[model samples]
Target: MGKLASECETERARTLTKEGISMDSEKVIKRDNEYVLHTYNRNPIALEKGHGLYAEGPEGQKYLDFTSGIGVNSLGYCDLTWAEAVSEQAHKLQHTSNLYYTAPCGKLAKKLCKRTGMNKVFFGNSGAEANEGAIKAARKYSFDHYGKGRDVVITLVNSFHGRTIATLTATGQEVFHNYFGPFNEGFVYTTAGDIEGLRELVDRHTCAIMLELIQGEGGVMALDPEYVQAVRALCDEKDLVLIVDEVQTGVGRTGTFLCCEHYNLKPDIVTLAKGLGGGLPIGAVLLNEKTAEGMGPGSHGSTFGGNPVVCAGANVVVDRMDQSFLANVSERAVQLRAGLAKLPMVKNLSGIGLMVGIEFFGGIQAADVLAACREKGLLVLTAKSRLRLLPPLTLTAHDVEKALGILNEVLTEMEQKAPKEQA
Candidate 1:
């Protein structure tokens, strides 16, 4: 036999090592800390590469990734099709200013509008930019139709919009408001699901109501469907633009093209990022008929917006969001939710589809759980105090079983260490 399979694999790895394809984890981490900004409290491990649902450390340690690069790797790591599309477009053309049109960009926009039933699409580089565009569009539409002074937009308290000055100001968390002084005006915050309170907040100054259908960073909390319907009705009654920020919940992240599908409502504007471009940087604002004319030339733009390479990658991702793919996503979500619910430490679960949040009882610290999971070859994330899991939608049943087993072991060990009364 031509060398055993394991031997061949070992030989390939050895060759790669000799060629210096991987480096010392400590050295890489040290270099990164020296050069990179200190904004993120990064994990100790230095990831080298990844394939499918797992990423490998520099030292050959493998990790089952539940975070999916914070929900950007919708197709998991290094998907061949996505990579090929990006590479092909890179060889052909990469970046072009919005002054000219490209086939990839136009095709991707058409696909997005077709899938989401939106009238127009504006591409950008990230969720924040998309939201910024949506905000501008809403304000402009209000100014054109209802005249000035109606520029205020109401966002939900506890919502996390983005990191830019405008988006940060729009974020409802008071904790994020520190040191950002005299933040952008015209943004108001209200409790999520309190339609009456939301109504009370709206006035002649209110132009739009923006929210995340599933608050991914705010503890993976899915807004109540009835409340969402009420909000839509209120928007219609008040003639205010409805903006849905699906940055984390869009592009099959929640087992649907958009989470708004689950709620049976289409808002006037939708902001998308994260999973939209698979692993690439891409953001989009989807406009409905009512707000299709909200933006005009010189109103808003991005230099790298609709970059051909990014659009090529996004085309593959969005094209795959068909009925069959989305159905599988839904099935996987059910499997994951059922498995997570069986854990003894899980107090409750929130979220729909692959977007999950596990609230633990017995005073279990989510940070401790995250660290333990990391040590045990699993990568997870935290939203507020809850353990958030946003695994790749393509994760198989076997992957779900394995992940749950690892999580169960971790939680069981933690439970055993808890005080008897608390346990």
Candidate 2:
């Protein structure tokens, strides 16, 4: 009798999975198309819930999440400690304008400053805003001290900055420069890892040289250490501000709290986002003392910046990302890279820590690999020509192995489907 009851319960669960909650995915997609703006090219499925390294769609199908919401959910979905802190803050005080002081924001700022050795911080709501703040600070610093004509900021080709008018202009990709007419001027792009190109570009009009330690969107390319050192020397020589955009690589993503630490270089301004708030939206610009003082009162502000609820969540994230946690991130990277390299279709693998990018041969599209992985109950991301994977730092070895097994199967199938080469 007990066995029969258990079988009945299992059948009920399967029926619920088939029926979904309200309706089928096709109906949901149609409804979304009618109501939601056509901004993102969304997938066919809709996610409903997520745990440590797995997410379930509305259809109740489970998937190992390697994308981690594009690297924002650092501690994974619904982390107990993070959720508790956020809930506590949400219950006590959700938000307050920056005009008044708040405990969580102050505590988070102090923690960030102390950990990073930066003098001060400016809070915002997204990575672009943080970069915008940094750009504004850099421009104001140059204008106040060096006077006019020092406005141009040199960035790297194929670099991914924010989507704001200023940050979009700062972004080096020509693809994003469309539709938006009359972008902000005084931003130039030089080839990555080219010291001579940067030197030639730096002139009387140059104010700063901004870069990402790892080009996340441009296929996870890490800058050469010698090239980075050259840029640092040039910035110091010309008294130009050095800005590092850590929106994707910051907060222990690259085995260090800051990716710049791997290069042994410090920047005048560092912009952070993505993982800082765990799952909440928060962005910050950490500045050195001299550059920080450039912004006086009434210069800049955001209404929802530094909300207590988000900061409370961020505190839990920071606490969990201590030295021991970061070491684990490094170890996982080695494991993932080694596993990926053994795959037949994987031509090359790049990136540091858990921020990995896998390149394939025989003209295998990243989209196809992503689709296959999804079909096999694994979720991943695509970066141009490479398949990107930004798994949660807290993912266990067992989860990693399971996800990699699915990836290997997908890549093998993709390779098998490719056409044979001409003799």
Candidate 3:
């Protein structure tokens, strides 16, 4: 959901012919503009390769990747274990549709269920699909038991679910309600931490309540633990399913496998993606026993849901987030937060583990600051009006310090320039 510092609008008058020419970064951008959909406003840098916590552009310019491809490159590009696993799986069995059984998918699902203490998992290709499947299960569960007119779901405002029509409808941000009119119905919204507002939205018709423990795209705001507890209690009292969308906050991104773990929660369903498959596309809907039986066979399915290669990559990614690695993430988060809070430009900070959001109080726009960061060989992201950082969990201490130095310098310059511009 971040914008590029500069638009990729450079016009080049070259076209590919029968004799294939190796494309450089600029050429790649031109080719994309020629072929790919214009849905995304992309960064101008066309990356050639990456390793550790850095990526190289077409001209071999190294960039310390703080965005981590919006937190997808969990192991930080070309990670040996993840790459090997994915490669081996591709060679052995690239894909097997839902009609057939695949070892990698089964193994990955079992590992997730065991680690999270969830009853079962439904694999999909992205976070939106995971959430879509979760919504279906919740609706089905209610239909099976409570009967009709109880299918409405309540979501918190400033929360983001996904781009799919159903998930988008479930998303509470009004800005995303653009050209896509007549969105799916049966969804309502409430403000974060407003127990009274949540109660007002709830009635006999509400079947489930979906929430992202931390609203990642909504400026990385974390809801109060007490408020989460209250929601859980309300769900229990009404026999309504609780769904946690951990698409961005799961898989150790929050210093724990699921952010709900930090709140001592066991929601009826939890969705995951983003960092799950290292750099590959994968997603999962983890269900507790209560709602596990609701989704029977033939109710929901995907063709490329649990491709063996993607699951193989996810296996290694999950293994890398074990106890010690998670502890290290927590330590690094503390170090990063302390350093960021001391910067003169940082107005406020929010987030957990390596997922961070920064706001500036010195009249500096998030886009301008990010453009400066990108110019200095740093890649970052913006959520709403805050500059968001999802640096790789594997980032070295030295790299963290170096990134902080760049940020400090940029903030100092902004702070000084703000007054001069005012004068």
Query: What C-alpha RMSD separates each model from the true structure?
Result: 3.7, 5.1, 5.8
Question: What would the per-residue lDDT of candidate 2 be over residues 1-423, giving only the tens digit for each residue?
Answer: 334445865897789778884656677788999999998988788787788988887678898999989999999988878887887788799988998999999999999999999999999999999999998899899999999889999999989998888999999999988999698889999999889988999999999999999999988999999999999999999999999999999998998999989999889999999999999999999999989998989988999999999999999998898889999999988888888888877889888888999888867889989988988999899998999999999988898789888987887776777876510
Candidate 1, residue 359: CA error in Å? 0.3
For candidate 1, the per-residue lDDT at 348 reads: 92
The C-alpha lDDT values of all candidates are: 0.91, 0.90, 0.89
Q: List the residue pairs that clash in candidate 3.
A: none
Instruction: Order the candidates by TM-score, highest first.
Output: 1, 3, 2
Task: Show model 3 residue runs off by greater than 4 Å.
Answer: 1-20, 420-423
Candidate 1 lDDT (Cα, whole model)? Answer: 0.91
Please provide TM-scores, in order, for all candidate models, with all chains considered together: 0.95, 0.94, 0.94
- Comparison by TM-score, 1 against 2, better one: 1
Q: Which runs in model 1 stand beyond 4 Å of their true positions?
A: 1-22
- Which residue runs of candidate 2 sit more than 4 Å off their true CA positions? 1-24, 420-423
CA shift at 306, candidate 3, in angstroms? 1.2
